[model samples]
Structures are given as C-alpha cells and as structure tokens.
Target: MRTSTTMPPLQALRAFEAVGRLLSFRRAGEELLITQSAVSHHIKQLEEMLGVRLFIRKAKSIELTPEGAAYLERTVEAFRIIAGATSEMRRQTARQRVRVSVLPSFAANWLVSRLADFMLKHPEIEVELEPTLRLEDFASDYADLAIRFGTGRWEGVRAEWLMNEEMSPVVSPALYDDGTRFAEPKELLLQTLLESWNPVGWELWLGEVGVDIRRARVLQLTDYNIVLQAALNGQGVAIGRMHMVRDHLAAGRLLQPFPQIVRSEKIAYWLVMPQNRRLRPGAEAFASWLKEEAASPPSPVC
Candidate 1:
C-alpha cells in the first residue's frame, strides 16, 4: 500500500492518463511508443499503488471505473497545466534563435551595419531583429532581448549599460566648399538646423554652446535617419550621435563642424533582458557576443 505522501511513478501516471483517455491498453501503448505488456504492467502497478480498481476489463474492451473517472479528471487537468507551462518555456527558449526588439533608427544606423559580421561568425545561430519604437516587456511572448536608449529606469528588467551617447554637429563637406559655412557656434544661425525626434535636441546642444536656444532656426525631421540623410545631402547641419555616424564620418560622407562634443545628460544605450526568466541558450550566445562587440573598439570604415 502506498503512503499518502508517496506519489506513483511517472510512467504509471502517463500510462494511466493515456489508457483512461483511450479506454484501451493496447492503443495507449501504441501512442506511448511502448509495448502492450509495459502499459499493462504500469496500469497494474498504478492501481495497486492507489489500492483501487481503476478500470473494468472486458474480454475485448475496457472502461474506467467510477473511481478511475474521478481520478482521471484530476490527472488530465494536472497534465494540461504541466503541458501549458512547458510550452510557454519552450517558446521563449526556441532552439538556436534569438529575437531582439529595437528602435528603427538604431536598427538601421547602428545594428544593421554590424549584423553581417555576427552572421558570418555564427552561422548556426539565427537572429531576428524587430524594429519598433515601443519598449519590450521580456516577460511577454515577444522578443528575447531589447536594445534601449534611455536612462535605464524601466521596471522589472535588467539593463546592462551598452554605450555612451555623444552629441556633435555633422554636415556634408560640400556644405562648406562654398555653399553654407559656419565658422563658429554663433554662425550656425545662418544655416537651417536639421533636427530629429531624439531624446537630446538641438535646443539642449545650442544652450551648451552658449547660443540662445530660442534664436536657433530648426527644420524638424521625422526620425534620426532622415536627419542624417538631410545633413549628408547638405540640407542642414544635424546633431550626430557619434556611434551612429562613426561609419559615415570615417568614410568622409559627413564631417563634424565643431570640436566640442557633449555627452547626453539623461540618456544612453542599454541592453535589456528579463529579470526573472533565464535567457535561452541561443540568446545567451548572442548576448555574450554582443557584449564583446560593444566592449571592443569598432572596426575602421573601409
């Protein structure tokens, strides 16, 4: 006789669950990838453990007894809960795949440029980039990780400081080759100030340079990419986030107008992940690689 504290074997529980559902030990064996004898053994053991006749056996069929019906109901419900939890965990840790939620501007200007190298190095792992302005809730069934640009005050997530933000003015070299020229900080008033939807704005930068924020003429653009495009085309001088424009600056597509650079007071880049859930193996690999990439100096523009 089994004690109240003692639980039946897992094999017996599985066999009972299947046999009670299908009403046939033979059919249950087939579903469980075992022989009919093994299924019978498990059922006999399970019935003896509980000291109850769980099934009524006929010559050609079997049916659950009243006691078995009640037990099976509870067993099936327990199985359902177990299966659901297992599925949710597996979905997050899907094999060899890492999904990331990031801002469109960062994805296009920063990540896209360096993604190819990661792919070449880790062909076995796959990375999916989901670009959106919305912040990710890692507890949800969405991205495995997130790249956030902020002061890292978000709740219920772990934020690793990724990089610092540098602010400076960038313009096309053509802008100065006889077109629009700014000799000093005060001369920028003569040019159309290209602005973007960013945490740090031209007004803040202007104030730092001793220029009256109200006196600055601004042309608002939709996003940072557009702002850079307008500056590259000599449309106006745009504030450059150094990490985003490093490649462009190195390639001579854009040039910094001033020697002074200011680090943002309240914002920078961070790698975010769930505080409670463990990262998938693939996500762990990607995260380690990403940290290494962030720590190392960036490659020179070719």
Candidate 2:
C-alpha cells in the first residue's frame, strides 16, 4: 500500500543493490551497519519507487526476483566501469607532476627537510610545495592535495588524519643559567617572558602543570615560529609544539623547563582532496608518503 516518492534516496538504491548482489538482506545489513529490517525497508522503498518486486521472500532464505537480477547485473557493470576508470586516471596522474599545499610552519620545520628523500625515491612524480595559511578550494584550485589542521570535515573534500599535536615549554639553555630557578611552574613564569601563540596557551600549559595562569606574565604572538626562535635566543620561554621543535630541542637549542604537557585541539594536520575528483596516482602516493612521514618519529636531530 506504500506509494513511491518522485525520487528515491540514493541510500535506498545502494541498500537494494547490496541486498540483490548478496542475496541476503541480513548480510547486507551487516555490511552496511544497519539492522536487517532497515535494509529490508530500503529495498522495499526502492521496489516501490521502481514499481517492481526486487526479491522473493522465503522462510529461510531470500532470492532475487527476475527484475532484481537484471538490476544487479547493470549495477555490477556500473561499479566495474567506475573502478576501471579510476584506475586509469590514477595511472595517468601518477605519470604527471603533482602539487601539494602545506602550512608554512609545518613546511619549514618538518616537511622541507625530508622532501629530498621523497624526490629521490619518486623520480617520476614531480612535486611542488605551495605554502599558505588560508584554505584553498581544491575543486577549482590548482593544488592536488592540501595539508590542513582540523577534523577533515570540509565540504566536497576528503580528509585523512596525519598526526596529533603535542606541546610543552621550551627555552634556551642560557635562560636556565640566568640564576632563574624554575623549580616550580609559577616561579618560572615570573622570571621569564611567557611567549604564547594565543592567550589560552599559557593558561593551558599552567593548567597542565597545576599552576595558576592568572598570575603568569603572558605575551601573545601571532606567529609561533617567531616565538620559538625568540626562545632559542634566550629571549623568553615559548610554548612550542614538540613536532615542530624536535630538531631545536634535540640540538639543545631549546630545553623543556617543566614536566607539563598540552595536547593539540584535535586539529592536527590532514591531507585533503576534492570529493568529486579521483586521486591521481602521484597525489595519492604523495599523500600516503606524507602521512607516513608525519606519523614517524622525527630524527634525533629534530
């Protein structure tokens, strides 16, 4: 007695396709992460929309009706064609050059240093790095992949998580010898310049160390890299990301003063690509390589 709508939901079509292909609504539900009844409803809705019975219900098993079999054949062929086209596109794209967008801080601190290795390995795939803080539109934009900070929920784009952010206080060795005893977090703040990327940075670090941030001397800087460099010169104590300051910290250019920790706001780097466009082989390979590199622990120098 159910009536069909002007258009059926693509979800319903997908559910029906799965059920028809598998010939088991229960199995389809398992694959789709829906209850068997939900999968059955989707197929029923599809059947109503198409005005054709898609399956013959049996006591113990389900069988695709004639109409369902025909539809399954076409859908399977469509999927195969799409897969073939995607493969061809990847092959062609891999053969050509690739462009990547990265954050200035990440590029200067991490990626650029190790880029030569990637180039040496992938001689065929040329890569160009475009540094910017602004998010570029990948649909009409020129770059193939963008490294960004966030949960990767941008509209019309696909995102893959790269790494988590870790932060701590860093200062030059000279600052420790300036007769400034940083035995306690609160005492250290009073003696050194509290360089902060944002106002909450000092507060977060203090909170992590069980110190009151309100009593700390806070100095805000828009560019964190500058603050880190300033810290290296013994100008002040800067809260720095461990990933970015790995080399500096290891080189004894910057030293941690407290046993405190600050995790990033779940907005670490991500690899983004256009939703509509299939990843060219070069882009996909580069993205994968970047993820692996980012996840790997930085060298002892870093």
For every candidate structure, what is the RMSD over all alpha carbons to the true structure, in angstroms? 7.4, 18.3
Give the lDDT of residue 161 in candidate 2: 85
- For residues 3-51, write the lDDT of model 2, one tens digit per residue: 3467567678779778887888889999999999999888888888789
Q: How much lDDT does each candidate structure score?
A: 0.85, 0.78
Candidate 2 wrong stretches, greater than 4 Å: 1-95, 150-156, 191-201, 264-267, 300-302
- The TM-score between candidate 1 and the true structure equals 0.67
RMSD of 1: 7.4
lDDT of 1 by residue, 1-302 (tens): 56454888889999999999999999999999999999999999999889999999999999999999999999999999999999988776654778999877789888887888888887768999998767798757689999988788789898888877778888999887866666889998888888776536576678789998577678887677888899998888898888789889999999887888888645578889988888877788888888887788866645
Give each model's clash number.
0, 2
Error of 2 at 178 (Å): 2.7
In model 1, which range of ten residues has the least summed lDDT? 196-205
